[model samples]
Target chain A: MLLYCKDLTKKFGEITAVNRLSFDVKAQEIFGIAGPNGAGKTTLYNLITGVYKGIGEINFDGSEINNLDPHRICHKGIARTFQIPQLATSLSAYHNIKIAAHFGNEKNRVDKKVIDDVIAFNGLRDKQGIVADKLSLIDKKLTMVAAAMATQPKMLMFDEPMAGLSPLEIRHLMDLFKKINEERGLTIVIIEHFMKVLTELADRLMILENGAKLCIGPPLEVTQDKRVIESYLGNCYAESK
Target chain B: MGHGGNLMKIKKDLGVLLAVYGLLALLPIFFHNNMSLMNILIISLIWAVVAGSWDLIMGFAGIFTFGQIAFLVIGGYSSVIFCKLFGISPWFGFLIGGIVAGGAGILVGLPCLKLKGAYVALVTFAVHMILEPFLKSDIGRAIGTGGAQGILTVPPLKIGSYVYNAMEPTPWFYTLLIISFIAFFIIYKVVHSMWGYSFIALRDSELFAQSVGVNAFKYKLIVFGISAALTGMIGGVYANYVGMLSTRILGLDLFLILMVMLVLGGMGRFPGALLGAFITMFISESLRYFDTYRLIIFGLLVMVLVIKMPQGIIGLIFPLGKAGIIERTILHFREKKAKKAEMIT
Candidate 1:
C-alpha cells in the first residue's frame, strides 16, 4: 500500500468533519471517492495532505505520517490540487509551475527539463506566459495539475477537479488524469461529484455520507449498494443506472 | 521565461541601478559648497535604504510590518549605547546594532507567523507603540538610554584617522552613497533569487504554497530578519552622521514621510523607492517657505497623485507597453504638427 489511514477523524468544535475513516490505497491504482456536499470528502484530502491535524494514524509507505506539516508531507512525495485551483494569480503560469518544481522536490536544484516536460504534457506550453488570473478556467486547472505533477509525487490527490468545467473540458481532464496515472505510474485518489466520471475512470470507488463511509467496492457494485443509493446516489441515479 | 532570460533581466536591472548611483556620485562635485543641499542628499540616501527595505518586506514578501521605525530607533540607540559603554569604534557599534535589531526582528516575527494581513499590521504596529514607553522607562535609563533627554554625544564614524562629520559633507555623502549602494545590491539579489519566488508563492496562498513544499513561516521570518538588518544598519549610520539620538525620531512625522516615499515610488517595483526618496526629499526641501502649510500641501498632493496614478511614478514612466507617458506625449505633438504641415502642403 502506498497510503494507509486508520480511524482518521477531524472535528471543528462540536461538528465532526471526518469521522473514523479507514482506507488504504495500493500503488498505481486510481481510487475514487464520491459524496454529497459537506460529507467530509475534502476533509479527508486535508487530513492526508497534513493541512489539518486530526486524530488517528496515517501511514505512507511504511512509516507513520501523522502530525507532519504540509511541506514535509509534500517532500515525502504526496501532492494535491485544490477545488478552487489555488495559484499565485499575479505570476505567469510558467512561474507558478516553476515554484513547485523548485521547492516541491527534495533536490535543492530545479530541473528545467522537468518543468518544460510537465508544461508540455499538460498542454499549457501555449498559455504558460500568461498570468494565472487571466487564464481560462480549464487552463487554470491544467496549470494547477502541471504544478502538482512537477513535484514528482508518489501519490496525487484531486479535490473535485471537474468542478466548474464544461462537459467537453471535463472529458479532456479525464483523459489527462488517465495519462498521468498510466504514463507516470503514480497512485491517484480523486474526489469527484460526477458518478459517470468515477464509474468510468476509477479502479475502485468509495461512497461517503455524513463524514463516514457509506460503502466501498467496485464502482458498479458500490453504486448498486442499497445504502449508498439511499444515502448518496438517490433513487433517480439508481433508476438511471 | 527560462532561467537564462531571468539572468539577463537581472543583469540589465543591475546596470540601470549602477547608472543611477553613478549620477548621484557626480553630484558632490557640483554641490560641494552648498551645505544644505548636501545634507538633503545625504539624508535622502539613508532613507532610501530604509524605504527600499520596507518595500522588500511589505510589497514583495507581502508581510505588512509597520515596525520599521521601531527597528530604526532600536539600531540607533543600541549603536550609541554600545559605543559609549564599551568605548569601541562606531564601526563595530554599527555591526552590533544590526545584529541586535535582527534578533528583535526574529522575536517579533515569531508571534506574527500565525497572523494574517491586517492582524500582522496591528501586531507590528503595537511593537512601534510600545517602544517609546519602553525606552523612557527606568530600565531604559539604567541601560544608558539617557531617559527623557536622550543620547546627546554620539561619536562620528572614523576610517583610518579620517573623521566623517557634517562640517565636511562630501566625505560623509560618498560614504553613505557606498553603503546605500551595497544595501540596494543585496535587495536586488534577494528579489531575483529563488527565495524571492517562494515568498511570492507563500504570499499568494499559504496553504497551497505549503502543499507545494514552501515553508511559509521560515520564508517570512527570514525576510523579516533580512529587512530589519538592512534598515538597522542604515539607522546606525544615521545616528553617527547626526551625532545624536532621541525619541523624537520615533515621531509619526518621519514615519509618514517614509511611507510617502513608498507610495510615490511604486511599491513592489525595484529601484522605485530610491527615486521616490530623492524626489520626495527635494519637494519637502523646496516647500520649506510654506512652514506649517507645507504638510497640508504635501498631504493634498499625495491624494491627487494616488488617485491620478495609482501605480505611482514608476508605473507612469515605464508602463508595461512600449510607450510611457513622456513618449506618448511627444508622439501626440509630432502627429499634430504633421497634420498641420499636411494641410499647408
Candidate 2:
C-alpha cells in the first residue's frame, strides 16, 4: 500500500469532523474521494499530511507517521494541496517552485536542471516570472501543483482541485493531471466536486457523507451505490433521461 | 557556473556595505555639533538593527509585531538594574537583558504560533499592558530604575580605544552601522537558506507549509527568539544613548514610530523596512524645525504613505523587490555551474 489510515478521527469541542475513518490505497493508483461539504474529506487529507491533530494511525510506505511535524511528513515523501490554492503571493511562479524544491532536495541537490524540469513539467515556463497573487485562478492552481511537484513526492493529494475553474480550464487541468499520473506514475489522491474530473482520472473511488464512508470501489460501482446516490450524488445526476 | 563571477558579486556587495559604513564613521569629524549628529547616527544604527531584525520575523517570516518595544524595555531596564544596584557593568547586563527579552519573546510567540493574524496582534497588546505597569510600580521604581524618575548617567558602549559619549556621535554612529551590517548579513544568509523558504512558505498557508514539512511552531519560536534578542540588545544600547532611563519618555513615541516606519516602508518587505526607517528619520528630522508639532507632522507623513501607497511608498517604486530576490538565486546558480564546466572542459 502507498498510504493507509486506521481509525482516524477528529473533533472540535462537541462536534466530530472525521469519525474513526479508515482506508487503504495502492501504489501508483489515482484514488478519488467524493462527499458532501463537511463530510471530512479535506480533513482526511489534512490528517495524512500532519496538518491536523487526530486520533488515528497513518502509515506511509509501511512506517507509522502520526505525530511527525508537517515538514517531516513532506520529508517522508508525501505532499498535498489545499481546496483553496495557497501559493506565496509575493513569490514569482518559478521561485515558488524553487522554494518547494529546496525542501525535498538535500543540500547542493537542486540546480538549474532540477528547477527547469519541474517548470517544464507543470507547464509554468511562461508564467514563471509572474508573482503568484497576480495569476488567474487557473494559473494559481497550476502554481500550487507546480510547487507540490517541486517536492517530487511519491504521493500528492488534491483537495477540490477543480474548484472555481472554467470549463476550458478544467479540461486543461484534467489533461495535466492525467499526464502526471500516467507519465510519472505518481500516486494521486483527490477530493473533488467535479464528478466528471474524478471519474475520468481516478482508478478507484470512495464516497462519503456525514464523515462516514458510504462505499469504496471502482468509479462505476461507487457512484452507482444507492447510498451514495441518495446521500451525495443526486438521483438526477447520471440520468435526466 | 563560474566561481570567479559569483565570488566577485559577493565581494562587491560587501565592499559597498563597508564603504557606506566607512563614510558614516567619518561624519563626526566634520560636524561642529557632534553631539546631535552622533546621537542621530547611533539611534539610527540601533533602529536599523532592531528594524532589520523586526523585518526577519515580520517581513520574511510574515508575522506582524507590535510587542517589539516591550521586548526592548525588558532588555534595557532588567539589565540596567543588575548594573546600578549590584555594581555589574551594563555590558553584562545587556547580555542578561537579551536573554531575558528573547526568552520572553519565545514564551509569548509559542502561544501565538497557534493564534495567527489579528489574534497575534491582540496578544502583543496584552503583553505591553502587563509589562508597562510592572515597570512603573514600586517593585520596578524601587530597584533604582527610580520608578517614573528613570535611571541617570549610565556608562556607554565601549570596546578597546573607542569610547561612545556625548561628544562622540560620529564614533557611536559608526559602531551602530557596523552592528547593523553584521545583523543584516546574518539575516540575508538566513532568508536565502532552506529554512528561509520554509518561513515564506508557512506564511502563505499553515496547512500548505505543514504539508511541505516545515514545523510552523518551532520555526515561529526561532524567529521570535532571534527578534527578541536583537531588539533587547538594541534597547540596552539605546538606554545609554539617552544617559537616563524613563520608560515612558524614551519608549512611548519611538515604539509607535517604529511601527509607522515598518508599515510606511513595507509590512513584510525587506528593502521596504530600510526605506521606511530612512523615510521616517528624514521626515522627522526635516520637521525638527517645526518643534512640538514635528511629531504631529511625522504622524501625518506616515498617514500619507499608508493612504496613498498601502504597500508602502517604496512599494510603488519597487513592488518586485520582495519577489526579485529569486533572480539573485538563479544568477548565483548559473555562475557556479559555469565555473564547474570550465574546470572540467
Candidate 3:
C-alpha cells in the first residue's frame, strides 16, 4: 500500500468530522471516495495533507506522516487540488505551474522543462499566457491540476474535481485522470459526488456516512451494498436502476 | 509564458528603471546652485526608499504593516547611538542599524505569523505605538537615546577626508541617489524572482500556497526582515543627513504623509512608489506658502486624487495594454488629424 490510514479520527467541538477511518490505497491505484455533504471526505484529505491535525496515524510509503505541515507533506510526494480552484489570479497559468515546480520538490534547481511538460500534459499550452482570473472555469481547474502535477508527487488527491464541470468536460477530466494514473504511474485518491464517474473510473471505492466508513470494496460490490444504498445512494438512486 | 517571454519582461522593466534614475541623476547638474531644491530632492530620495520598502511588504507581499516608520525610527536611533557610544563611523552605523531593525522585524513577525488581516496590522501598529514611550523612558536614556530630547549630535557620513553635511547638498544628493537606486534595484529584482511569485501566491491564498509547497510563514517573516532592513538603512542615512533625531519623527503626521506616497503611487506597483515619493515631496514643498492650511490642502488633494485616479500616477501613465489616459488622448488626436486630412483630400 502506498497510503495507509489507521484509525484516523478528528473532532470539532461537539461534532466528529472523521471517526476512526482506516483505509489502504495500493500504489498506482485509482481510489474513489464518495460521501454526502458533512460526510468528512474533504476532512480526510485535509488530515492526510496535514491541513489539520487528527488523531491516529497516517503512513505513506512506509513513513509516518501525521500532523506535518502542508508544505512538508507536499515535499514528501503528496499533492492535492482544492474543491474551489485556488490560484494566483494575477499570474499567468505558466507562472502558477512554475510556483509548484519551484517549491514543491526538495531540489534547489527548478527544471523549466518539467513545468512546460506539465502545462502541455494538462493541455494548457494555448492558455498558458492568459492570467488565471481571465481563464474559463474549466481552464482554471485544469491550471490547478497542472500545478498539482508539476509538484512531481507520487500521490495526488482531488477534492470534487468535477463539481462544476459539464458532462463533456467531466468526460475529458475522467480520461485525463486515467491517463495520469496509467501513463505517469501515480496513485490517485479522488473524492467525488458523481457515482457513475466513480463506477466507471475507480478500481475500488469507499463510501462514508457521518464521518465513518459505510463500506469499502470494489466499485461494483460496494455500490450493491445495502447500507451504502440506504444512507448514501438513497432509495431514489436504487430505484432509478 | 516561457523563459524567453519572462526574460524580455525583465529587460523592459530594467530599461524603465534606468531611464527614470538616469533622468533624476542629471537633475543636480542643473539645480546644484539651488540649495533648497537640492535639499528637497535629497529628502525625497530618503523617503523613496522608506516608501518603496513599505510597498514591498504591504502591497506586494500583502502584509498590512503600519510599523514602517517605527522601523525607520529604530534604525535612526540605533545608528546614532552606535556612532556616539561605540565611536563607529557613520558608514558602519548604517549597516549596524539595518541589522538591528531587521532583527526587530523578525521578532515582531513571529507573533504575527498566526494572525490574519487586521490582527497583523494591529500587532505591527502596536509596535509603532510602543516605540515612543520606549525611547522616552529611563532605559532609553541609559542606552543613550537622549531621553525625550532625542539624539542631538548624529555623526555625519564621511569618506576619508570628505564629510557629507547639509550645507553642501551636491555630494549628499549624489550619494543618496546611488543608495536609493541600489535599494530600488534590489526591490525590482525581488519582485521579478521566484520569491516574488511565492509572495503573490501566499498573498492570494495561504492555504493554496502551502499545498503547493510554499512555506507562507517563512516567506512572510523573510519579507518583513528584508523590508525592515532596507527602511532601516535609509533611516540611518536620513539621520546623518538631518544631523539629529527626535520623538517628533514618530509623529502621526509624517506617518500619514508616507502613506499618501503609497496611495498615490499605486500599491503593488514597483517604481510607482518611487514616482509617488518625488511627486508628493514636490507638491508638499510647493504648498509651503499656504502656512497651516498647507496640510489641509494636501489632504484634500490626496482624497480627490485617490477617488479620481485610484491606480495612482504610474497606473495613469502606463496601465496594462495601451489604454492609459495619455495613450488615449494621443490616439484621439491622431484620429481627428486623420479625419481632417481625409476631408482635405
Candidate 4:
C-alpha cells in the first residue's frame, strides 16, 4: 500500500465532515472515491494531504504522515489537485510547474527541464508562457495536472478532475490520467462524482455518505452493492440491477 | 515558429522597458537642479522601493497588506534608537532595525495567514495604526525618535572617502537611485524565479497551492518576512536621507500612498511600481505649485487615474494588451495538433 487511511475522522466544531473511515490504497492503483456533495470527499483529501487535522492514522508508504505539514507530505512524494483549477493566474504555465519543481528533486530541480517536460506532457508548449488566468478551462486543468506531475510524486490524489470539463475534455483528461498511471507508474486516487467516468478509469472504488463509508471494493462490486446504491440514491433495493 | 514567438515577446516587452528606463536616467539632468524636484525624485524612489516590496506580496503573491509603513517606523525608530542610545554605528543599526521591523511584520503576518482576501489588508492597517502612539511616547522619544519633536543630526555612515552625509543632496538622490535599482532588481529576479511562482500559486488559489505541495502558511510567512525586511531597509534609507525620525502618523499614510501608487501604476509589475511612485510624487509635488487648488487637483488626479487609467501609466504607454501573442500562438498550435490527431486517428 502506498497510502492508508485507518479509521479517519474529522469534525468542524460539532459537524463531523469525515466519519471514521478506513481504507488501504495499494501502490500503483487508481483508487476512486465517490460521494454526494458535502459527503466529505474534499475533507478526506484535505485530511490526508495535511490541509486540516483529522483523527485517524494516515500512513503514506509505511510511515505515519497524519501530523505532517502539507509541504512535508509533499516532500514524501504525495500530491493532489483541487476540484477547481487553482493556478497562479499571474504566472506562465511553465513557471507554475517550476514552483513544484523547486521542491521536486535535486536531479529534476532544473526548472527549464521540468517546465519543458510538463509542457510536453500536457501538450502545452505553445501556451507555456501564457498567464494561467487567461487559460481556458481545459488548459487550466492541464496546468494543474502538469504542476502535480512536476512534483514527481509517488501517488497523486485528485478532487473531481472532471467537474466543469465538457465530455470531450473529460475524455482527454481520462486518457492523460491513464498515460500518467501506466507510463509514469504513478499511483492515482481520485474523488469524482461521475459514475461512468469512475467505472471506466478506477481500478477500485469506495462509496461514502454524510462522512460515513457505505462500502468499499472492486469497482463492479461497490457499484452493485445495495447499500452503496441506497447511499447514493435515497433507498436500497434488494435486487441487483 | 517557437523561435519567432519568443523573438516577438522580447521585442514587445524589453524594448519598451529599456526606453522608459533610459528616460528616467535623463530626468534628473533636465530638472534644472531644482531641490524640490530632487526631493521628489528621492521620495518617489523610496516610495518605489516600498511599492516594489508591496507588489512582491500584493501584486505577485496576492497578499494585500497595508501595514508596510509600520515596518518603516520600526526600521527608522529602531535604527535611530540603537544608534543614539546603544552608540551603535548607523550602518549596523540599519541592519538591526530592518531585522526588528521584519520580525514584527512576521508576527502580524501570522494572523493574516489564516485570513483570505481583504482581511489581510484590514488587519495590516490595524497593525500600522496600533503601532503609532507607542512610537510617539516619551520612552520612544527618549530612544532618539525625539517624540513629536523628532530627531536630528544622526551622522551618516561612511565608507572610506565617501561620507554619506554630504550636504549637496546629490548623494541622497544617488542613494535613492542605487537602493531602488538594487531593490527592483531583487524583486525582478524573485518574480522571475520558481519561488516567485510559489508566491503566485498561493496568491491565485491558496487551496490549489495546498493541493500542489505548497505549504501556504509557511510561504506566506516567508513573504511577509522578506517584504517587511525590504520595507524596513527602505525606511532606513528614508530616515538617513533626512538624518532624523519624524511622526508615526505618516506610517499608515505612506502605506496607503504606496498602495495607491501600485494600483495607479500596474499591480504585479516591476517597473510599474517605480513608475507609479514617480508619477504620484511628481503630480503631488507639482500640485504644490497651484497652492490653492493643489490639494483639489491632486484629488482629481487620483480620481481620474483610478477611474480612467486603472492599470496606471505603464498601461497607457505600452501596448501591453497585445502581449497576448503567446495565447494566439498557442491557439495556432492547437489547430495544427488537432489536424495531426485527425490524420493519425
Top candidate when judged by lDDT against the true structure: 3
The candidates score, on chain A by TM-score, as follows 0.98, 0.96, 0.98, 0.94
What fraction of the real A-B contacts shows up in model 1? 0.55
Model 2 misplaced regions, further than 4 Å = A12-16, A104-114, B1-34, B78-97, B136-148, B159-162, B249-251, B285-300, B321-345
- In candidate 3, stretches whose alpha carbon ends up further than 4 angstroms from where it belongs are B1-5, B289-308, B320-322, B325-345
Docking class of 1: medium
State each model's CA lDDT, in order: 0.88, 0.76, 0.90, 0.77
Question: Quality of candidate 2's docking, in CAPRI categories?
Answer: acceptable
Alpha-carbon RMSD, each predicted model: 2.9, 7.2, 2.2, 6.5
Q: Write the per-residue lDDT of candidate 4 for residues B78-166, one digit (tens) a residue.
A: 77777777777777877877798789889999999889878998999887776766667877666566767777667577666788753
Residues B9-123, candidate 3, lDDT per residue (tens digit)? Answer: 5686688778889999999999999999999999999999999999999988898999999999999899889989899998889888899999999899999988988999999
Question: Interface RMSD for every prediction, one decimal?
Answer: 2.5, 5.6, 1.9, 3.2
**What's model 4's lDDT at A135?**
82
Instruction: For each of the candidates, give the backbone clash count.
Output: 0, 13, 0, 0
- lDDT for model 2, please: 0.76
Once model 3 is optimally superposed onto the true structure by TM-score, how far is the C-alpha of residue A224 displaced, in angstroms?
2.2
> CA shift at B219, candidate 3, in angstroms?
1.0
TM-score of 2: 0.83
Q: Over 4 Å off in model 1, which ranges? A: B1-12, B289-308, B320-345
lDDT of 3 by residue, A80-141 (tens): 99999899887788888999999998673588899988988999888888778888889998
Cα shift from native, residue A108, model 2 (Å)? 11
Model 3 gets an lDDT of 0.90
User: True contacts preserved, each candidate?
Assistant: 0.55, 0.46, 0.60, 0.54
DockQ of every candidate: 0.53, 0.31, 0.61, 0.41
